[model samples]
Target: MSILVDKNTRLLVQGITGNEGDFHTRQMVAYGTKVVAGVTPGKGGEWVLNGKIPVFDSIRLAVNARGANVSVIFVPARFAADAMFESADAGIPLIVCITEGIPVQDMMRVRNYLDQKGVRLVGPNCPGLLTPGEAKVGIIPGDIAIPGNVGVVSRSGTLTYEILYALKQENMGVSTCVGIGGDPVNGTNFVDCLEMFEEDPNTEQVVLIGEIGGSEEEKAAEFIADRMTKPIAGFIAGQTAPPGKRMGHAGAIIEGGSGLAADKIGALEMAGVQVAQHPEEIPGMLK
Candidate 1:
């Protein structure tokens, strides 16, 4: 089984009236996700996308009335932290913040509150997670993934897509594909998704796509070395990243020797994870 979300999840869109919200929400619904309700303050008492689901004024009302357990936020960055707390307060167990540009300090505060409340968050700047052929909770391309036995977890959204494309070229299918996001302070990390994949029966192998940034990869390596019972193949992006320079992803910046791609690859190698030298080689490594 997939972790976090499956076909049974009931979704609530926070900024349902916004353009981004409308776009992805329709795609999610079209992909067969159970989008039960929406929340948009003044837009409450209105209907979204063919009047399929009811829109409420607040997250609390939507959660309470529709029994929504999962929430996907499309609110602007200025109010993203509040949106997160709103979902947490409403007691939604899982929340995915698709909004970008949230202040770092605000995100830290939201993370602290979520920690205290025992809430699980996916991203504040992420592509989200998808359980192939089951349910999708973020902005990942649904068509690229097919239900199978391999699990993919990545830091780069585009790289995640590349990995999936490579895997599909090799005729491999994925059980779940997660874009843990590129934010420095995202909700989920490599190790978090790894743990979930380790426990999923459908996952026969795992592909961890990492990028230059933080000690997250090192932490994940240590965890896998000591705890994992499955075969893991990994690839750390930005190998060609110029020293003392940043990359495209905001969180891909290198500083203080912490976010180097070499360091992450070294750590994963020490952990017994097969490290791929190129993106194109990932599928072969998994095989």
Candidate 2:
């Protein structure tokens, strides 16, 4: 009952020949994701990862030849928007863009295109999504996840990993973990994953790992209060972060008091979501 990916997810890597792309391709294969093919323009007709994956000239070719329904973009940020458009044009239903620093305007167009085609895009600066014991996409560590009823959605990569580890350590495994990316403009948002988690029968609880920026968390809290019935826990980072400073992530900038950690915490608390002071406290709240 995984939401986005499972054993049957035939995957395509858009820039599979490059350094980051190649490394993660191998990692994904080792984690048992059905990485059927890769796309690297001029490298077509070639084989990557010791000839295990065939390289295609285009996403269309990869989808045509490999039956790839999902695609991950490891291409540089400058070309990430194009890669996303290409995957959508080629009819890839699910796309995960790991490249960071993509211009906001480019993503605006890409987002519209994806919406028009009904594509599910995970990120542009993200750790990717994982369905424990089922499929691994993006860069999430496969070992930290275990198939269970709790669904996790996060805005930070490292924080997501930490939460997953704590959950597994406490024997509270997850159904799906989605890193929706922390960029100001990208594909997917907290509410989108939350809704999916709400509808997933396998999921009994939900965990939201948000940061001190963007009303995305606040918005998600509103949705949870109104529509979601699943028990949810939350942990918002950057509690003491400097105001107006961009904290590592492009979207983690605290402007005025709108996107502060305290505000996020208060909103989630008001929505009846247990707010955890630390990720370790999250597993306990799920109980």
Candidate 3:
């Protein structure tokens, strides 16, 4: 009952010949993800990982040959947008983009195209999603997550890992942990993930980890108040960050006094969410 991905995911890796792609592909395989195929353009017909997975010249070929329903992109920033377009055109329903530093203008176009095509994009600068004890997509470590009822959605990659580790230590497991990314124009938002989590039968509670920048948290708070029935615990990062400063993420910046940490926390609290002061406090709050 994971939200997006699970053990049945037949995955294909775009840019699988590159260093990052090759390395993480093996890690995903080791974690028991059904990595059926890969795409590396000129390296078609070759085999990687000791000849276990077939490499294709394009996503269309990979999908047609192996029934790859999920595509994970590891290409560079410059080529990421085109890779996404290719995947969508090739009929890959879900695309996860892990490459960072993509131009905002490029992502704007990508988002529009994906919406028009009815495709789902996880990230252009995200850590990807994890379905514990089932499938591992993107770069989220598979070791820290175990199958359970709580659903996790976060805007920060590193903070997601920290919260996951703490939950593991407390013997808490998650159904799915989605890193929607901290990009200004990235695909999928907190409200989207929250909706999925709300509809998922296996999810009994939700933990939302947000940072400064963007009105995403505020928007999610509105939705939580209006529609959500499950108990929610939250943590907002960048409480001490000064105004007009860009934090670690491209979208993490204070602008025109709009994206203050206090404002987001207030919104969530008013919606009846238990807000945690620290990442480690999240597990207890959820409990």
Of the candidates shown, which would achieve the greatest TM-score relative to the real structure? 3
Scored by CA lDDT, what does every candidate get?
A: 0.89, 0.91, 0.93
TM-scores of all predicted structures:
0.97, 0.98, 0.99
Candidate 2 residue 4 Cα shift, in angstroms, is: 0.4
Residue-pair clashes per candidate: 0, 0, 0
Runs in model 3 lying further than 4 Å from the true structure: none
Model 3 lDDT tens row, 1-287: 88889989999999999999999999999999999999998999999999999999999989999999899999999999999999999999999999999999999999999999999999878999899999998999999888899999998888899999999999999999999998988988999999999999999999999989989999999999999999999999999998888787889999998999999999999999999988878888876
- Displacement of residue 34 (Cα, Å) in model 3 is 0.4
Model 2: per-residue Cα lDDT over 1-287, one tens digit each:
97899899999998999999999999899989999999998999999888889999999988889899899999999889989988998889899999999988998899998999999899989999899888899999899978999999998898899899998999888999999998988788999999999899999999999998889999998998899999999999999899999898989989877799999999999999999988888888986
For each of the candidates, the C-alpha root-mean-square deviation to the true structure, in angstroms, is 1.1, 1.0, 0.7
In model 3, which range of ten residues has the least summed lDDT?
Answer: 278-287
